[model samples]
Target: MEGIIARRVIPSDNSCLFNAVGYVMDHDKTKAPELRQVIAATVASDPAKYSQAFLGKINEEYCAWILDSEKWGGAIELAILADYYEREIAAYDIQTTRCDLYGQDRKYAERVMLIYDGLHYDALVMSPFEGAPEEFDQTIFAVQKDRTIGAVESLALNFARDQQRKRSFTDTANFTLRCGVCQIGVVGQKEAVEHAQATGHVNFQEYR
Candidate 1:
């Protein structure tokens, strides 16, 4: 089993995904906007292939919104990047220890770590650095022992089960809230509605 050598914390200011990918590819976090442009352009170039069902309700304006540095990115954007860069993207949902892989069918799959915790994105690079930092913060989850794909296979299944539990418990309002402004999960509708009332964030989508 391989060990993690270094972890880079991308700012959680909505551009975390682009920033993380930029850091992983070029070691330059400042290039986030450039990466964003690449993604937006990739999608904009072929809206027929990328929009509608794939983009959900985001629509054509999503391409424009994604160009903004304050916009958040997700699986859709990750898949676009995987196709554009022709590399495998391994996104780990740390909250449930679930791993989502993209671009597996590519002839070459250059692995890049995307550490996610429902809302933010960070990156972890494997061993062999010239002068790597010895210390890592809580944002990092360095491997402590040998791990195989089998060891983590249950995580996604467990996450699904947990979601099922939540769905079963809440019969009155069987839905989850995704913030329109920041694209973060806001738990139940009560909290989401309350948050909107308190913060004037009226835009939200209910996901089952």
Candidate 2:
């Protein structure tokens, strides 16, 4: 399959992109800050290259924010890290169910794997102990462009059905809830229930 054959799970704490790179490079999450530092410097070094238009409301502060261990990273950060490391990076988009390639033009033989589920990022790497694929070793995969494209499309169709099932769960992230007794508002069902149990307030209402 032109998809992730093996994987590592990055912490869901928004720094998954950088952590993924760290795993691929050193198999250490602590190295993630090194990746973040390089990326922040890359963006700060040339504002024109990563213009407001290209970054879309992302400014210098945003670059600094990316260095924060808890902040999320996106494609722009991913590309910068790939270019800095001079490695081709493959991000498997679970929502699209296909892998997207970055940094092919860079001069390095190394490759890294990242997994994105629209809202979050994770890491995927070929299993080191497993037998290598026939065409390539566990570190890399044969670049079958046509097959990858077709596979991505097919996966997208199937991914849509999966999203349908998750639609309600996804919607709840932003749906606010107000406690009737306390009048203190909160978000998500879990928190609401927790607040009710702790405060002994049973009444609740949803907001949007």
Candidate 3:
């Protein structure tokens, strides 16, 4: 019988991407520090390929930035981790309901799924039943298994759509946030960015 694809929500401690990747790769969620080091080392080893032009920051700065646990990881981090692990990372977006496949061209032998809700990342797993334990979860799928891939993709899309309908995503553009450092309120991503830039306060909590 086929299994059910579900989202394994990672923590919101700003290391969701790394934690999600860790969970799918090793069933271990506390590997963010190690993964961050891996990405930093990889970038340091390939200065030309991961140059400031590509990374939007100097190679050394990018490496240091990634090492900070508060820094969020995105496509660059996903691509680097995909190459490092030699597996395809398929990220499904809740807002767009689109699956962005990293390392898809490399034809990696294994693939893992992740759910992205604008600001956060979560792992996707297949379970024997609707509420099975994490020990019974299957996070990796064979890349060449067309039938299984199709089923997984369909389920991922459905899950994304369901999340979208429920407004389970953060509207970063217009969300209200309070700076964790100064208890100052900001409206939307623009104001938040401005506040962070001016005060160097990176911690923020969303409020209704």
Candidate 4:
């Protein structure tokens, strides 16, 4: 159901045409109740239906980073809870007109994981994809086309990408912006450049 929220999210501009990717929150609230309401309501519907609608929306602005064929492309990043969601979501296995169990499935969810394996990876892994000069950005398209192994593994791939440019990107240089109203990832992007304006570079003065 969590993944469903992301699927078929027909973007308005019709520009990217790929998955709409944007940080769901300003901070690492991907695990917070504000967002978790959607996940929690999904798995524990006593009547087998949620009493309330989920609070999240489909990210339409920066889908490129998360799903762009040139970037991570078509592949869904997995988390540890994905394993749990997969079981819970699969247990019901019945699709409703209104439930998106997230992009989590037994196969895909297996990839969902904690920011760091032992909680040592820091928030860097969970940080939004604002200025993410991703280490493993070959995309799912490339992975499939090249018959490459581990091409879609974001964590491992990112580690490699970061390792490759260790000095330029840095271990502590994650960037983000907040959604203003929701404050998703738009706060610090005062001078930040987005997917559409790759050349815009650094803080957005208008945001300030």
Please name the candidate that would achieve the greatest lDDT relative to the true structure: 3
Report lDDT per candidate.
0.63, 0.64, 0.92, 0.26
Error of 4 at 8 (Å): 27
Ranking of predictions according to TM-score: 3, 1, 2, 4
In model 1, which regions exceed 4 Å deviation? 1-5, 127-131, 134-208
RMSD of model 1 against the true structure = 8.3
User: What are the models' TM-scores?
Assistant: 0.63, 0.61, 0.95, 0.23
- Estimate candidate 2's RMSD in Å: 8.2
lDDT of 3 by residue, 94-201 (tens): 878888999987888889999999889999999899989999999988876452375677887898899999988888888899999999999988999899999999
Clashing pairs in 2: none
Candidate 2 lDDT (Cα, 0 to 1) = 0.64
Question: 86-135 in candidate 4: lDDT tens per residue?
Answer: 42111001111121233333334122211221101112222224344433
Write the number of the candidate with greater TM-score, choosing between 1 and 4: 1
The prediction achieving the highest TM-score against the true structure is 3
Error of 1 at 57 (Å): 3.7
- Candidate 1 lDDT, 137-177, residue by residue in tens: 11222221233233223433354345444532232243587
Better of 1 and 3 by TM-score: 3
Stretches of candidate 3 exceeding 4 Å from the true structure = 145-148
TM-score of candidate 1 versus the correct structure, residues matched by position: 0.63
